[model samples]
Target: MARRGPKSHWWRTRLLAIAIVSVWAVVTLALPFFNSISNGTGPGGVGIYVFMAEGVLVLMLALVFWFARRQQAIDREFAMAEED
Candidate 1:
């Protein structure tokens, strides 16, 4: 079996970071278009604006946590995780 090293780890980390950022950017940029289509109808009859205001915040927080979790897993795979 071929042994991977720091270079491999670095690329994996970079790719994951890019993917996370891309997801965030796409969702944020598409928000306005979705809002326009949905108009004032959202979950529980809430307006798109209201749902977006709260939903975006939640989405951001979720993404942050997701990134942290995934990053930690990558670090562990590379045997570089910090002591906790």
Candidate 2:
């Protein structure tokens, strides 16, 4: 009988991707509005801080996705080697 690989990691990666996109959407859409309402600042007022925060979030999300893709590639290579 052929062996089936584990699938939990696949689901976990999918969940992580979904969570990352959701958070990115929230940060991109909500932060500026909240900042403006709370700080009475427009996109040019203390809004620089909001932009900085969004930039950090984008960097983090990019790192996370990159790491996940690298990990998947490594896993695929290992699996192929094991099948030989």
CA lDDT, every prediction? 0.82, 0.61
Task: Tell me the tens digit of each residue's lDDT in model 2 across 1-84.
Answer: 213445744655577677767766666667666665657455475556756567767766786888667656545643532332
* Per-residue alpha-carbon lDDT of candidate 1 for residues 10-74, written as tens digits (9 for 90 to 100): 99999999999898887788876766686757664466687677888898899999999999988
In terms of lDDT, the poorest run of 10 residues in model 2 is 75-84
Which parts of model 1 have CA positions greater than 4 angstroms off?
Answer: 1-3, 33-46
* Candidate 2 Cα RMSD after full superposition onto the native fold (Å): 5.9
TM-score for candidate 2, residues paired by index: 0.46
Tell me how candidate 1 scores on lDDT.
Answer: 0.82
Per-model TM-score versus the true fold = 0.77, 0.46
